[model samples]
Target: MNTTETARRTAVLQSALAKQGIEALVAYGSGPRESAGMLRYLTGYMPANTEAFLVVPAKGRPVVVSADKNRARAFKTRLGDEMKIVKTTDLTGALKEEVASAAPRGGLVAQAGEFDMTTALHAEFRAILEPYEVTDGYGIVTGQRLKRTAYEAEKHRQATAIADKLVAHAMSIAAIPGVTGPDIMAEVEYLGRRLGADQAGCWLAVGERPAETYFDLFELTEAVGPNARVQIGATVCLDGYYSQVLRIGMFAEPSDRMKEVSERLIAMQDAALARMVPGTPIHEIVDALETMIDAYCPYTRLSDPFRFQSTHAMSNSYSDPGAAPFLNAGRDKSRDAESPLVAEHQVYEVHPNFTLPDVGHVCAGDVAVVGGSGATWMSQYPRGIVRLA
Candidate 1:
């Protein structure tokens, strides 16, 4: 991130903090495996083995606290002298001191836990900052992450392009005779890493006939027959942004029944994409998909054992909000389907899958971005079946 972008994001978050009556904000990341989102968002640097925290007050320059001197020196060189980088053995003490320095008045302080806070970390934070109120700032950071910046959108586009390339490569490999599903999966993972992907993972299913079972990489051991149908669902992450591509391929000629089912599934996906415009409620998008499925495949009910989410938010994580918005036959009041609106620059993976009684299971989808007027696709692979010779 450049200086201009950093300034813009800091201003945005500080404004949000002021509005929420928060005097200071402390965003923490415990090593590389946990709570790295907010820390990366603020510093543009991801921690590998050390814990880090970013302190942003209602006013003033932000201070970054690194767990060790080595990491602190590296950040100092990277972020320059404009931003303060402090080395501290006691992370909670450093956080309290920085917050107190920023907000001498001792108003409410928000700590971003990212997902959920563990009891140990929460108790430690509370112990140091006595008399001052501490609240969860996960929403404050994630709310900003939901709307992608131009830089973030470009990163997502690159990630999607990589996913499309991998899908095409997987299709070509799946067409080869005597190749096992696990072999193809290994090649996909290898190529994804060679293409500069930070992390890559996928699910592969191969069967002579359409099988309702969708297996992950570990479960794929059977050799793909000459005329088997293959399904590849791939996800690639580049620079912390993620994109997905799901496709179906056949080694031999697709039968008439396969073509009909593939067409119906593609039509339903297309209808749903058409309605994914800016400002549209998530529930309305689900409704449009449900209607299309009923009009085209009336017998297909949401009660089918193989049904999955129709739409889901995508970002650095595979599932942004984690639990995605789904469409069901009967309105289940228990689902949180309402209130979230698709805003400009938001990316969603529109994956819709259903089981066909005779032909097994059919699935198709790609990543799309919500624009000013409508949604545009990030992945360019064709939606229908890709027949291979």
Candidate 2:
């Protein structure tokens, strides 16, 4: 977190506050399980305990509230004197005190209730603030985060590198006969940690017959047989940022039909990537993808239960914002709905998964950064089928 980055973020947040007529903004995050990313995004620090709060007033320096004083001290060193640290036992009470002290007179306040604020906590804030109106602050923060900064893009690149390494390691071990889904999953997680990833995990499915429906790695116990089809969906997080990489592995020779379908899927992925230019409407991208898949591989149309959308934005957290801007046809009513314009510096995962008529599931994608002219892939691993010995 450099001075420039901090200044940029603060400016954007202050602008948002002015637009919303909010006198103060409060964001909360519990550890990894909940709103941790929100806290990390605002303060460049994550809580070691149950919860942390970031209070940004319309004026004066920002303050970070946490239950653990020791953790707060550590953050103070990194964040410098511009950020004030407040240690308290009562998290919500401390927040109310801060808001009251900052605003004094009753004024509109915005709170990020979506992340870590529970119903009781929200009520506590309202009751404590009294006349001050509390509105949703999630959009204000996320609106600024929708576009990645250069520093953020670099962190995502590092995270995606870790994900690529994990996927490569999983593919290397997946080819051996008798390997189970959990086997590959475990190796990926282990290697991901060794590579300095904050956390990592993936879902795996393995089966011999091409027609055999894949099951979760937890529920499946059968060893992968020769000619097995494997689908691995892997994610790696580094410093609160996340990246996803999906791969398909074939243990033995692929049939002609399987080869054809895999080629078509890869082509579809390439076409989608080509369209991820800055300012392109998300609906146009989806329309082009739908047209291509329908024309090339009609069997894997949107009507198929196995088909999924090819584009999704990835950032500080996996599926941040929660609502996917694009969805495969027939899956969501908003499939054709317009989404925010694709802006430069935004990152996305282009995983297009669908099942072939007689073959199992096929999945392949990599992290990509949107560029002025087009999108550039962060993960260098090949995008097509991986044939294992």
Candidate 3:
């Protein structure tokens, strides 16, 4: 993140704090996963080998807490000395002191995120805030992340470009006479790492779709056979931002039934994509999508044998069934589909996919951006199945 962009994002969060009358905001990030997403958004700090925390007040210098002095020093040099980097052996004491500086005695303090935090870490975080009135502050960050800035979109594009190559290579390798799913994924990983990707992962399913819709990568030992109906997906992260490409390809020409279903699935996805207008309610889109999908194939995401959805939101986090843009039944009724307006620049991974005995899992999806007037495709690869014959 550049200096200007960093300042812009921090200002947005601080403005939220001021509006909510919260004294200080504590953001927890534990070791390089989705939990680190908020910390990265506010401070451009990605947790390397250890857990870290960012404490930002409505008005004051933000403090970043680190356990490793070497890691702190390296990040300081890379990020410059604009913000304070505190090397703390005593995490609770440091957090309390920093909170004291920004917050008034007996004032309210809000936490940015906690759902993904480890249990022991969560207890420690809560222990520090137990003195003050606390409220959930995740909405504050989720609001900002779902919208893609030109900078974030650029990173997504770079990741998606590499993801495209990964998918294409996997499909081509499947056409070879003898190759297991893992064999192809090994080459996919090497290709992604060689091209400057930070992290890469892929999923594979060959032959007719199994009884279950969700396919596990660990059990992907089946060899690619002639005319095997293959479904594969590839995702890579560039600077904590993720991009993915999913496709269904065949070694032989796709059967007529397969072609027809692929077109229907893509059309169903388009209908939902076009409904993503700014200011629209998130649930309204979900309801409309379900109705359209049920017209051809009766569906409800909640009842899935695997907890997947027809569409989902994504940002720096690589976790599945993302938060905002689409919310399921949960504690935060406010964030449920019925609430939360679709922001102007929201991003989503749209896939109205399902399994069929005739064609296997019909996976086809792309990253979508809702900007300017309507929806636009972030992945250069058009949404459809491929035939390598």
Query: Which model scores highest in lDDT?
Result: 1
User: TM-score winner among the candidates?
Assistant: 3
lDDT per residue (tens digit) for residues 1-389 in model 3: 66677778878888889998998888877666566777767766575467777888888767888877876785576456656788888876787788878787778988866786778877888888877899878777776676567787677778889988888888888887778878877888889989888777687767755333323546767677775777777888776677888888876666687778888877777777787787776665556666666666543444443324666666677632235435432235555644656665566777666655444456677777777667777777655667765
Ranking by lDDT: 1, 2, 3
Q: lDDT of all predictions, in order shown?
A: 0.74, 0.73, 0.71
Q: Candidate 3 clashing pairs?
A: 283-337
* TM-score ranking from best candidate downward: 3, 2, 1
Winner of 1 and 3 under TM-score: 3
Which of candidates 2 and 3 is the stronger one according to TM-score? 3
Q: Model 3 shows how many backbone clashes?
A: 1
**Which pairs of residues collide in model 2?**
none
Per-candidate Cα RMSD to the true structure, in Å, reads 3.6, 3.3, 3.1
Give the runs in model 1 whose Cα sits over 4 Å from its true position. 30-35, 45-52, 66-90, 209-217, 293-303, 322-338
Off by over 4 Å in 2: 1-4, 31-35, 47-49, 68-82, 209-217, 294-303, 307-309, 326-338
Assess candidate 1 and give its TM-score to the true structure: 0.84
